[model samples]
Target: MDHQTEVNVGGPRMRPVQERSDHTALVVGDFLYVWGGYRSISGEEIFFPSDEICIYDMRSGEWQTRPMEGDIPPSLSGTCGSYLNGSMYIFGGCNDNGHSNQMYCVNLLGEKYIWKNFTEGVESRPTPRDKHSCWVYKDSIIYFGGYGCKQIRDVHPNSFTIDEASWAVIGNALFRFWGWNNEVHVYDPCSNTWTEPHTTGSSPTPRAAHASATLGSRGYVCGGMENMMMDLHYLDLESWTWTNIVSQSAVPQGRSWHTLTAFSPSSLFLFGGLNLFCEPLSDGWVFDLETAEWRQFQHPHQDKPRLWHTACLGLDSDVVIFGGSRDYRMLMDTIAVLRFPSLGHCSDVLIFQTQPYSLLRLCEDCIGKNAEILEKQLSILPLKLLEPIQKRISFFRTAVQTDKKITCT
Candidate 1:
């Protein structure tokens, strides 16, 4: 019910010459850890993979570059990851050569956070792929749909059926036949085993550069190419059924390479992707998992297109979008905070006093600033404090009208 918009929290004032796109950034406590992504310059078709890791400190509001230790991962793009048990597990990504099935993990809470390869121990694994979706369910990391190790057919636009029309039409080829991977693989760290779960009902088609977020036992996925799909699908992990959620709400445009961060554990915020025209997008949308609705957020940064970037739900349900490529322009360093409505973060600024006037004045200030979610803050306020805040709001409105009349005379 509370609201916030994207605000650029500038960081990494000085960036390295090597920029990247299609990377992943994760939030662990107050820091955001960024990993490998490919870079595309304006003229060249060349893609340079980043081997280093960048850390953005929320407390300092700056970015730090760190060298990868232990066995380092190669420059990769369209990679996916999940953090659990004090360690982050990284799966498939595409390098300069091709997609990789390699898996690795880094312990953030350990004495020394180092990367360790675990792919050799797993006998069965998902094929080398990139632009896949990954989410944590219980203790297991579930991997689904991305480009796989298969020969792809580049068919003309005229050949694809209407249902599969939205799939990525890369260059002259309207449909990529084989590269669209539709398989689902689940890895259990407890057993170090990979298993393909049996999924029933309807499921999503092969896709790449899509995003997924876990809400309790259920997993929701949306927007990707191979079919530039706009439909939202949820998997009731308990029943192992994929239900294509049909919402009365105006769904977002079918996009690829977007970021979805779970806000407030139950709600989700989606941001930035390339649309059907292959143009980069900057618009943001909020989706309620319970109601199956999508509402576009009104933000000042509507013109700042972002794609192939990483966004994470940070301190107090605030969604942060950072480090993306705008068209071919590389944006490897930038921090944006989508502040959600929450009193938890408000404590830093709001000083609660015995007098309700203090809180009332704060409410009036928020209203003066044209903050849309002023009403939402009331629900979280103590019952005893509500009356004073409401009274103060009414008095302020009346004062404003009187001032307007005096000016008119």
Candidate 2:
């Protein structure tokens, strides 16, 4: 992290909890649910899993602790989860004993919420592991590579269509991660079956702690460190191909334990995590998937670096962030909310955000276009579109004058 970075807590969330890291938290309706992670006790760091569910209400901006009703999960970390339908599905993580292949679900909207052991009656389960990435894809929870019984790196149901294949063994399984995997596995929520699908495109290197969010049929993963990943990849669920987003401007440094949340359908917000130097980063980023561009969100206004924390988008463009550690300081049980300024309207914008960057890169094409075509295009350029393009050109012009390379577009 740069010296200018700051990580002050935001919003109205103001209670203190034990300093913790590697905890899993997700959004369900009006509440953000936080569970199991490692916490410090008398200078001895330990797994602090508890049955108590930590609930943060977006509407009230308050914390409410509730006890679990059934089959409470044990103390653990590295487990990942996704919210689908009305319940949140949590799968495999390690505990004091070891890694667990167990899967559980809790109904967030129910009056009396209880944990359900959905792992029961399942066949062809992913090996017990932690640091694995999983997201809800339609009717299934799609799981990607992680650490397990051993390093697993194969895509299930590889290459061929879903057939009358046995769950015991899959046909056409593509071996992606001989050591670290980029393989994709689909877990059916209804049948409780796991299938490895054949993917066609080149895959990401075996990585862990990478943040993922579902955008339509694509899953966006960004800023994970197999070593140090500033690179971003999106998997097309239908084609099983990966597209790496190459952006101009200053990209957020590669870091893990950072949180990535889809604040808007077309955009995502990524915030605080540790850098390659093991420094707590207060850096923030806004990724416009529509433009495939990464816009850095300045963090000079805050004073705490968030690492291993979780971010959830609440109503009215608010980013609700939960606890994570910053260097030696385990954070207070504080909830911070960063409110994004309104960008007004794009309801009539017709220009592609990437086009400006593209035009800046390849000027000949812009020069070659007929005045009629260009006039039509320029006529509808909304203030939203014009502002960024002007900014990019200004930024690029300065770079050109400075003899620095233009990485835009």
Candidate 3:
């Protein structure tokens, strides 16, 4: 059996903006942008109409706040946003008044933020809805699955190409499957269309509220409620097929309203959501693509069981989890990081490597156990040409010491 070493890379740290509540967070380049939701104070739920945008610097661990400029969309929840070409496009959220069909973009081009409204092209906008998933594929923003007024509308999976300045429905009109729409949809900017290719095996049931992450030519969807589902599925972009991979025993309890992030093709992390009973959860799970397994991570802090919170992978392989509801009240400004231990050790050596950053971290972990054996088996010239293995040794030492220094948050 292989020996696994688990290490807590950083002590518990919270962001300063704990006053403003939010749900979804997106990491674009070096900045982490978080948007608005309801705030809770003194047992009262306060709906914030303020268009406040908070930016966190990954390198410095500092935060800057700014008012959303121009025609600000109304405050809402269950909306989705993605960053592309140094700008962010936000669409489809539900406010107390009703679902919004409005789409807006924040251009991060200059020091001053510029917000552009797409109301002039209102005829091409998607129907007003909430709880949909949106992502950027090349130059287009692809949106899929959400709650409509009477029933969930899966009929209108939409894509917008900024270059063409047009919105078009892609794929045949399919009924919205309840739960998380774990289906994988991609938009090619060049073609200005969506493709749902036929797969060989059985695909996951149509569901909503689940999470997905894209790695290279493949996308993974996992851990969402489909009446009673607790497993995972993946779509190979090249083959256009779906495969159900068996999850390991320590897998998370069946959940919904959680978040998944693809730090690399092999390392996907899921954080916080509600169980079948509808209770909030804090346990974290890491899905290993190489092994096709899930490993549960239990944090010392039980205070942050956030459902409907947002998570995004950082440049250094750190996963940042931010605001969700705690005890039915929206949590403002609460944040935590699950640092990938291997990042600090191998980054200097693999500086020119083309692999995604998360893969390097996994390689460090996989090789740690057999370092001595590997050193003896490989030829001297090959070993000499390799990056110094001493960093791995150093990492083990620090990890052992840090493991002994575990403190609760």
Candidate number with greatest lDDT: 1
Top candidate (TM-score): 1
Instruction: Residues 164-283, candidate 2: write the lDDT tens digits.
Output: 222223222432122234557898878878898877665666666677777788887776646466877788988888877778656778887677777667887787777887677777
Better of 1 and 3 by lDDT: 1
| Tens-place lDDT digits, model 1, residues 171-270 | 2262333346656788988788899888898888767768788888888888887665588888887778888888778888899878877775557778
TM-scores across all candidates? 0.70, 0.68, 0.63
- List candidate 1 stretches off by more than 4 Å: 1-18, 42-51, 151-177, 328-409
Whole-model lDDT, model 2: 0.60
Worst 10 residues of 1 by lDDT: 343-352
Clashing pairs in 1: 166-228, 167-226, 167-227, 167-228, 168-226
Which lDDT value does model 2 have at 407? 30
Q: Kindly indicate the candidate among 2 and 3 with the higher lDDT.
A: 2
Each model's lDDT: 0.62, 0.60, 0.54
> Clashes in candidate 2: how many?
13
Give the Cα error of residue 257 in candidate 2, in Å: 1.4
After TM-score superposition, the amount by which residue 3's alpha carbon in candidate 2 deviates from its true location, in angstroms, is 42
- Which residue segments of model 3 deviate by more than 4 Å? 1-22, 41-45, 119-126, 150-201, 238-240, 248-250, 329-409
